[model samples]
Target: MKELTKQQSKVLACVEVYLNKTGFPPTRAEICKELGFKSPNAAEMHLRALEKKGYISIQSGSSRGISIVKSQQAFEKNVNQMPVIGLVAAGSPTLAEENIEKRIPCDPSMFSDSFDYFLKVKGLSMIDAGIHEDDLVAIKKTIDVKNGDLVVVRLEDEVTLKYFKKNNHNLELIPANKDFSTIEVDLREQEAFIEGKSVGLIRTH
Candidate 1:
């Protein structure tokens, strides 16, 4: 494959992330918004360049018809295959056999540590950290986490992503967004426990 320009590389990464998250390509307008392009035409131009470079295939006249060429996957063979876990009921394991929705391909080198799975973010709690709704958060499975770490925690059966902070008395789950209130769990009474630490994020347009 030919080298991609910086802007073209951003566009290609956006498309690849979106495809890995949703199993389909993004629309031109989506690409424009994601890359901060002034117009969809700019996105179209980048897509054309990507196609010319043999990175992606565009289906003429079809909306959201972009597809990554199979050869591209060959280059990403070292990428990790992580399960995208869905809902976790209170008292159940975070990656229980029944909670897995599907597995998605992730670039392992994106993080320093290997990830156990991906969790589909569902709310605006972590928006200040640029984590948006529907984003895939890569989680390294571990119970050992420190203060100020972005972690996946289970309170009883409910699971959430928050900045972890703990003291002698209680655990604080801090939300990045000001609109949401911080969660406080009593260390002695609650069933709260760290499931994993968030190592990376994959945002789709």
Candidate 2:
């Protein structure tokens, strides 16, 4: 709802990622470390401004309790110049901040819809699908999907990448690894959420 300055947005974005990881907001010092601020007070100043403008809120006496208050709809529509890091899980959601490796510039037009962020691949889990470690997976931040699409999903609260299949009410996640078994879930038995579908890929070797 409120316009954030470039610095404010940068700091807030980092804070949001960190919060997703630790389940607690970052301290001023931690924020400084991530943003290259010379002093904790510099981070404090930015945090205060974000709070004053309604972008975030501070919980008294809590070290990691800063909360981001932006709406998902607004975030998707107004994402201008936001750095795309990698992809997050759709079948298995990983909100952990440490998984976010680096920031890469992206043209959001490459995706069919809005995406909140990107997750860097860490292993060869999807090598057969051409998704390698250190690759950047571009995901449109939406839940709607179809068969044969690559998706990031959270299974049992852990983030995973896979191709999706739906038959009646049975959901299946096919892995790229031949050694791995396909994960099947009954919508009535387990809860699964699709973070987004893989729209594009970035590779650097």
Candidate 2 local lDDT, 37-84, one digit each (tens): 889999999989989977678897887778766522234433443344
Candidate 2 regions with alpha-carbon error over 4 angstroms: 1-100, 111-114
What are the lDDT scores of the predictions, listed in order? 0.79, 0.73
Winning model by TM-score: 1
User: Tens digits of per-residue lDDT for model 1 on 148-199?
Assistant: 9999988877889999999987899999999999999888887687888988
Clashes of each: 2, 22
How many pairs of residues in model 2 come into backbone collision?
A: 22
Which candidate comes out best when scored by lDDT? 1
Q: lDDT score, residue 176, model 1?
A: 96
- Taking every candidate in turn, the Cα RMSD to the unseen true structure, in Å, is 14.7, 12.3
TM-score of each model, in listed order: 0.57, 0.55
Model 1: what TM-score? Answer: 0.57
